[model samples]
Target: MGWLSTIIVGFIVGVLAKLLHPGNDKLGFIMTTLLGIAGAALAGFVGEALGWYAVGEAAGWIASTVFAIIILAVYTRVIRKR
Candidate 1:
């Protein structure tokens, strides 16, 4: 159940990130989901480091989406160079 929820949330976050980001990156469903998961993970670490929020907070969703966009940016850059 936890894993299922994570995937669903990741998909939502990834879609949001893709829609919100300025530039475009060619990504499949799995890749997009992965981007979201990675971004959320990154945001979790950053939030903890900066003391912006607590673990498992709903506020983390916004940060997660933002971080997903950032990751999307970097992913596009790297892919473009390849």
Candidate 2:
């Protein structure tokens, strides 16, 4: 996908992640988008390493969501402590 498409998908994924995760994260638009992009990147890397996806392949929604949730958890932990 193109960069624009990726950004759009990342935004959607981020929104979903925020919704799926319990509690209010208080993240703004840019942070949420970055969170989603980071989650997608994490899922893609792990999937590729495990041979579940080929190079340049995008991660599926489930994997992206799962990764996003994990990221959100970490973000909450680290940010809330500050």
Candidate 3:
């Protein structure tokens, strides 16, 4: 996918992940987009390592969302402890 498409899909994935995860995560639009992109990248990396996906392939929605949620949890914890 192109950069623009990746950004668009990342935005949607971020929004979906925020909605699916309970609790208030007061994040702005830019932060959410960044989170989604990072999450997707993380998922893609792990999936590739596990032989679930090949290099240069985008991670699926479910995997992206799951990774995003995991990132969110980690972010919340770190922020809380700071």
Candidate 4:
């Protein structure tokens, strides 16, 4: 149940992040989902280190979405540079 919810949320977050990020980066749905999931995981670590949220606590929807977008942006930038 927990894993299911996480994947669903990550999918939604990934779609939202992809939409928010304006570019021509071609990525399939699966790739986008993976990116989103990775973004969420990264956000979790960042939030914990920055004291933005408690470790193991649920990240609010908006925060997670924004965090995912930030991650996506950085990812795209890095990919572009390479």
Candidate 5:
């Protein structure tokens, strides 16, 4: 469930994140989805660890999307630096 949810949530979040945060992100489909997956997982674990969410509950959509945007920004920065 976790892995499948990650992929599904990743796709949804990826589209939303990209639309909300249009910048110098030269990401393709896979990379964008990867970004979303990373963001979703990050938010889920962090929110859980921070007590923002319960253990079994997935991160909220808004949280996932926002984190995805943050991840995208960080990604672009790293790419730019490299």
Candidate 6:
């Protein structure tokens, strides 16, 4: 159930994150999902560090999306090195 929830929430986060970011990301659906999942993890860490939320607490769509965008940006930069 945890993984399932992550994917579902991640998808929603990915969409919102993409919307939040300016300019097109040119990412496919699968990449978007990956980004969302990664974003959730990133957000979770940051949120925990900043005391925004509990370690296992769920991140709302907006927060998740913003985090996803940041993750996607970093991922893109790393991938471009290849």
Candidate number of the best TM-score: 1
| Backbone N/Cα/C clashes per model | 0, 0, 0, 0, 0, 0
User: Which residue window of length 10 is worst by lDDT in model 3?
Assistant: 53-62
Q: Quick one: how many clashes does candidate 6 have?
A: 0
The best candidate in terms of lDDT: 1
**Candidate with the larger TM-score of 1 and 5:** 1
Candidate no. 6 TM-score: 0.74
Each prediction's Cα lDDT score? 0.89, 0.85, 0.85, 0.78, 0.83, 0.78
Error of 2 at 38 (Å): 0.5
Better of 3 and 6 by TM-score: 3
Q: How close is candidate 5 to the true structure, as a TM-score?
A: 0.81
The candidate with the higher lDDT, 2 or 3, is 2
lDDT per residue for candidate 6 within 38-82, as digits (tens), equals 888777777878888775555545566788888877776777788
Q: How would you encode candidate 1's per-residue C-alpha lDDT over 43-66 as one tens digit per residue? A: 888998999999889878999999
- Give each model a TM-score: 0.88, 0.87, 0.86, 0.72, 0.81, 0.74
Model 5 lDDT tens row, 10-79: 9889889999996768788888889888878788878877888775554467778899999998888888
Q: Which residue runs of candidate 5 sit more than 4 Å off their true CA positions?
A: 55-59
The best-first sequence of candidates by lDDT reads 1, 2, 3, 5, 4, 6
Candidate 2 ranges beyond 4 A from true positions? 54-59
Residue 76 shift from truth in candidate 3, angstroms: 0.8
Better of 1 and 3 by lDDT: 1
Estimate the lDDT of model 3. 0.85
Q: What local lDDT score does residue 71 receive in model 5, on the 0 to 100 scale?
A: 90
Task: Give the clashing pairs for model 3.
Answer: none
Ranking by TM-score: 1, 2, 3, 5, 6, 4
Candidate 4 lDDT score at position 30:
85
Please tell me which model should have the higher TM-score, number 3 or number 5: 3
